[model samples]
Target chain A: MATARAADEAPAPAAPAFDVKNAFRNICGFCHEDYGRKQGKGPQLMDNPNSDDYLFNRIRNGKPGRMAAFGGAFTDDQIREIVVFIRKLKPNENP
Target chain B: MKRHSRKAITTASVAVLAGLAFGAQANEGILKRSANDWPSYHGDYKSWHYSDLNQINAGNVGKLTEAWSHVASRATRGLQGFPLAVDGVLYYSSPYNQVYALDGATGQMLWTYKQKLNEDLVAKQTHSPYNRGIAVGFGNVYMGTLDGKLVAIDAKTGKLNWETKLVNSEKLTVGFTGAPLLVKDKIIIGSQGGEWPWRGPIFGVDAKSGKEAWKFFVVGGNEGTASDRRDTWGGDSWKTGGGGGWMPGSYDADTDTVWWGTGNPAPLYDWAGDEWMTKGPRPGINLYTSSVILLNPDTGELKGYHQVLPHDAWDYDPASGELMLIEQGGKKYVVHPTKAGFVFVFDRTGKPVNVYKGVDNINFVQDIKPDGTLVGRRDMKEGKHGNLCPAIAGGYSWNSGAYSPKTGLLYKVGFEWCMDLEVVKTTPILEPMAQLNIGANFTFQPPKDGPARGHIRARDPVSGKVKWEMKFKVPPHGGLMATGGNLLFIPEADGWFSAVDAATGKVLWRHNNGQGHNGGTITYMAKGKQYVATVTGFGSLVGDAYGELWGEPWVSMPKDAGVLKVFALK
Candidate 1:
């Protein structure tokens, strides 16, 4: 009962300081490497012509037989954060 | 130094392991009797990569032309495997786990087997999903998937027979990159995520039910004989000591032994902050991490093991080397080319017979103990060690070396660059989904003496002495294929598929295919003529490992250009 009260009373956990650069370098960069400038296992995620909804759905649900689903692993907010980060990725000649 | 006695046999148990009753005679005969059939991944069980076909000789190789070409539908990454030609169809796998059966004579597709791996499965893969190739036996083509499934499909119909999850990818970040070896009735596959803190094992899945037949962990665990292995890890580091067997194992039908090489310890650099004097992330000679492990293919029982580099600080993974069976002076030896720049020769019983530097200026290993354990450079711990030659890819990596009985030489493609090692304080176990969990990182910087280069050497397997060597601008990426016609065929990173004289390492013929070759090459007889097949398009992480000091060819490769090229006498 006390723990429940504390949970109800405490402030919500703050969103993480999502280091987009480090996050890309660590995760998506392994395949859609060079800040998503070049294609790898997946197509280039930057300067993509797809909509936000398409990118978000694809990132979350993942295409069958091709990409993996990250919806279960990442929170909705986290996915949004990643999508926003990806949207800002600029295209460079050298990946 | 321990030995496992042979299993006491019973009629039922023998049948289960050997599959005497359910023997696929046709596939067995192709592997055992035929020289023209590229049945197994290493061509045959011998892992020689040598073809006895001499229809296209060095004298006439200049007339060789592209017989045909096939482009994979979704080959976005580098192609890293050869096609397995059996009967009249050539079976090849793309990096996306799609297997295609093409007409051996013509480049027409017979059937395509595409195994869909979801993002969750693909995320857990330790390396690129580029399967080396599929193994064929029992009328089925067996492949280990990036999602940790041992998938068997009907070789003719391309229908899925059975799919077995070999590793718990959800629990451990490990998957299969090696091709499954169809031995007897068992589909044997090994793990590939040692970098993700995987405790290694070679799994034998029952060919019929897809059930695990037996499992032999490279690093022993808390079981009967494995209890002794606990002391080797500092603290609980043994729980996730990386020693994955990423490459396929060689089957010795003669001794019933399957020889496999194991990868590096978890965290490429094991020491942390002055802990070299006290407690390290991983201490003691990390047993079985960088070694050639011999096992009884029937029971998955350990026969013996010989560690190539003990307490490996450098990422000198023995797992990438192909286990070679070379006979010297009437005695047989299991030769291994390691990332530590040495080709190690050992007797069949796991006794180290000889070890010599396969490349030039290997100063990482300062001394070698009497028992073959290396005394590496002490300064390599917890700090920047300048100019470590044969860097992480070693003298060679997963690109297999070929041995020819006719020439009595081993043809190896090796890198001649050195890298600077930088170790920083890091967590012990590789975090579940981290990019690199090691204590150190490396960047390619040329030695003070010369520029970074690659070499293809024809060396004596036993003596480790180079007979004749040819240099390349960048490291050659594919496996070597030696033919009986005094010609050596190898694929290069610079988009050239060239042939050199086997006796003298002279470039005899060359073809510019406009894409680099980073996979294995195979030769087989189709109809009455002989043909050579190899996949092109480079983009191995080894290419990404170097810096600008090397060259653009070393790092910059165009994506989605993976194509299989076939050549024969025009």
Candidate 2:
């Protein structure tokens, strides 16, 4: 029993919550409407539900001649996190 | 019997005269002349964008109607190029390196040349792959691509004659967005990579063979080259100094020199940006960039240059505007509407004579020296967010203005917006492929006083006085096309192409065709009928980049199907 003394270890820190508001204010909101209340260069994203597949492809591959693809800029996890934040966006929400 | 004979003979004579007139106008188009055909960008060597065709005059412009429209299948972004008209066939270039030759009279698709550009490669470009237009010379159509290739296709067959790689995209990310200027036997093309970590260049190629003739480096201090002005730059800053030749240059046959406006210097905050705990590397006035450079058209030799913005950080590009050669007080002067919102008049020897504040909100420079040297603000170098007028888009943009030899006035569209400026220390954000390395960031801020607006200004080139200005709700995006009938044709970003009174700035006629009209206006005649044509759509790097401030209902408006709108008087 003495040979099997338990060693104290710190559990992996929980991943920091994604700052969708900060990301929206700094990057996405520059081109799209802030909080998705109005249309900017890109279409309004509020009150609209897009499939995960459609959102993933559009964000990764981008619609040529219209939008810039973020697949290369953002990682798979980061993009997924962004999509999650986008899904939680409510119409008329003042971000 | 006598009356019938007289009527028949008179009718025969009138028909014969009409046939002769048609032949003359047709020849003008075939020969690439300016008066009757828009053979080149800016309409002619004078860069006037004016036509002597009076058929669609002020009295008859109200009757102008859409004759026909051809919807292009690809490269359907905003059409920014001036379609070249020659021998009844109209040729134009679109985004993604697509070329189309359409029937000038019927809008029928004659032939289309679609370049197999790698979308992955094009996505790496710093700017949109929109080609301003094609150059017609040596019986071939010439165009520069976003992938950095100079292509020549047979005008009649649309066959690829030759394709030459002008700039290596891997070494330095660059693209061609302006039309190539066919000067004499040489096809002069300007490269667009100002926003990248690049050493810009202006290349002269043999028109017939597509062989490189000469190259003029826009940024100075290249190793083993005489253009080294190392003293002007601190450390090795000259290696990546940004001074691109983005827009098509104007040539002066009188001086046998090519006059091109150079873009802003690299590290937009080189002189500022203390928070990054960094000082500007290129400390002295960065030569060549943000200036009007004069060079030998054949050999690419630097003759002279005049810096319009010394130590500039607001991304003010002087070369995006038209360079007008005018005679004031029996002397010749080059009138350039600078991005700083000033109409700068320089003598033929590259000496600044006068600077006039064309817009009301330009507060960056308090004064301009007699030789066109700029006086910078004291706070600009302090690295603090300060309110700067005319924004980064400035009072005017590359939507080149027109100078009417008839009116002695220059008609240009102006923006009345400003931006915020400051310096930050952090890793530079690089776009895909490191195509853009802008060392700092700024935001387009609307003026605190009022909503942003645009103006259609008629300025006298001699006195630098505004004769009249027509304000609008939306900022205009296209250039001006003046006709001999005292009409100035311009398009708005809000989807209306209107014809204004060239003399008084009166809105004579406007049509809401439901498309953001940002393409260059061009006019040509076929069979004695005058037609004014421009492309309409809603995608522009400038328009979209500043969408938060200038776009609203504009971005929400239903866009047109990228139609080649050709109007003719009924």
- The whole-model lDDT of each prediction reads 0.70, 0.69
lDDT of 1 by residue, B1-570 (tens): 111132212234323323211234433643573666788888777788988889988899999999998988666557888788865568898876898888878988878998867656565343665777778766667888776778877666676767777777655655777887777767788887556655777898776566788877666432476324545555556666777788887877778888888878766675443243225666556677777888777788777888776666777888888778777889998888877777778888888888877777577777655357666554465656677776666778788889888889998887777766556545532333433345553555565567777788888898877788888767777888999888899887778889988999888899987877778898887787788999987666564443244445544566566888999898
DockQ of each: 0.06, 0.06
Query: Lowest-lDDT window of 10 residues in candidate 1 chain B?
Result: B1-10
Q: Which structure among the candidates has the greatest lDDT? A: 1
Q: Which ranges in model 1 have alpha carbons more than 4 Å from their true place?
A: A1-95, B1-33, B123-126, B226-228, B273-278, B369-371, B428-435, B546-550, B553-556
Error of 1 at B496 (Å): 0.7
State in Å the error of residue B186, model 2: 1.0
Clashes of 2: 2
The residue-by-residue lDDT of candidate 2 on B157-232, one tens digit each, is 6667777787776445467788888777688888885665566788888766778888877766344656655445
The TM-scores, one per candidate, come to: 0.83, 0.83
Candidate 2: global Cα-lDDT? 0.69
